[model samples]
Target: MQALRKYGDPEYWNKRYSTASGTFDWYFEYHPFIAQILDGFNSKEISILDVGCGNSKFSEILVSKGYKKITCIDYSKAFFEHLFQEFHERLPSVHYMYMDARMLSFPEASFDVVFDKGLLDSALTGELSYVNAKQIIKSCLRVLKPFGKYIIISHSDMETRKEHFLDPSFDCELRCESIVVTDNDCHEGEERLPDLTFYAYIFSKHLH
Candidate 1:
């Protein structure tokens, strides 16, 4: 928590997203690891909330796959506006909201699936990385139904260790389901070169 007090703030993330110079601006569409995780589940009527979902192309994919309830949240209004303008009418099933992932105001056990694509990693980039990560995770857990899944795509190996800390609070098992090392030359010679290997963690709520 002290780390977030030192660095993880809305301004920091907003600025990071606002800059076109950052790698985030050149993020790839449809996270493969998240797609794999979702493939493992068989439920049809799933409620999914994608945290820090900046210009998420994943929403379009989900809509094409017939997902009815989809919500995406991002802290930056500018990014959200760009996303909305691009996809608002194209995919009406997607509900976009502007809010900090750490301070989500939703009822407990509200969603069937909570997926994050590098949201926690962005929070952890600053000094209060750990605290911000925890805050987001807690909010995710709060909004996840019992036995629901919390999927996170993080660049750091510490997410597994951090999950142990959250076990006491949420009674869930955080398992590292997959690691996708992408050399997707989709943007060859682009200004931003993707260098990180993303790890997908699936945190399943333990039913009593």
Candidate 2:
């Protein structure tokens, strides 16, 4: 169990992405719900920050949709090599940085939209789970503009994940909906993996 603590370390993810098979997207990409996620927002105008962007191609897909000013930050730089190799020069248009989600370096109210696809869930499984996960969410709120949207696709249920967003400490209003997603991408066993259902949480920060 002590070794599992490395899951929270950047080096562990760096090594994984450097040697992982193919291009992987945790909890799938945002292609299916692009409209729902970006509802009432101009994708081309709003600045987006994808927190804990691993090897996910969601940012690339957003770029293709003409969403300029997309920034992806991950703790590991090793994934950058795979990104550049897969997307070529097009990736240069989207900002990529090696940064920690729990302690973002961006200024307050810096982004209009932030996406967390499986990031919080992954964090919850790591060492000091509650502290690490709460810090990430708090940092997201701090960096997000008033009325900005934080979209999270997590494997955890609403009961488990909602408290962080609804906590009195944070000034935000949240709504969640369940989505049935196929886990065929998971290769855990020979038997077919069950169709997994999870929640899509959208938390809009109240104007201060």
Candidate 3:
């Protein structure tokens, strides 16, 4: 964490995805949790935003699933441009915005569903970890309508931080809907890291 605090900034993430040197691949799309959340929604004209929506492939999936209103935001211009160029013509219905998740400029109660895949995890590594998390949650809450759902897929540590971020006025619930365990050393050629577990949290906004 200390090491990440020293250098993990927007530039760090931008560079990670900019050159393909990092672990992320353009082919990676929405995770299982995203599909689960989408499956639970019955609304046809729901307002949705994918924070740190890398590559927009997930947004494309939402389009295929018949979601008419969708928007994606990311801080990396290179990545956003790459996704835009790849899918703009194919899925013109979805809008792409270049912005930081921690500082969103949208009206209160604007979106019915808000999803964050790995953005919070990425931001939780830097010097501004706490501040970033707080700001992102605050902005997200401001834009999320009453009775809306906020879905987050994060590392176990970040999942634990959700309680601290939730406001006292809002009644929140945390559930580990699924767990992903990756096998280490599956490939015969080289040694690999230990298994990683991701926790999915579903936050529901309570209305009066």
Native-referenced Cα lDDT, model 3: 0.71
Per-model TM against the reference: 0.76, 0.84, 0.78
- With a 3 Å backbone cut-off (N, CA, C), the pairs that clash in candidate 2 are none
Q: Write the per-residue lDDT of candidate 1 for residues 182-205, one digit (tens) a residue.
A: 656657666655565656678898
Q: lDDT tens digits, residues 81-169, model 2?
A: 65545644657788888798999999999999989887887777787888988899899989999888888888778777766667888
Two-way TM-score contest, 1 vs 2, winner: 2
Model 1 weakest lDDT span, ten residues long: 19-28
Ranking by TM-score: 2, 3, 1
Q: Local distance difference test, per candidate?
A: 0.71, 0.79, 0.71
For model 3, residues 33-77, the per-residue Cα lDDT tens digits are 566667676776999999987664677678888999998888887
Which pairs of residues have clashing backbones in candidate 3?
A: none
Clashing pairs in 1: 3-128, 4-128
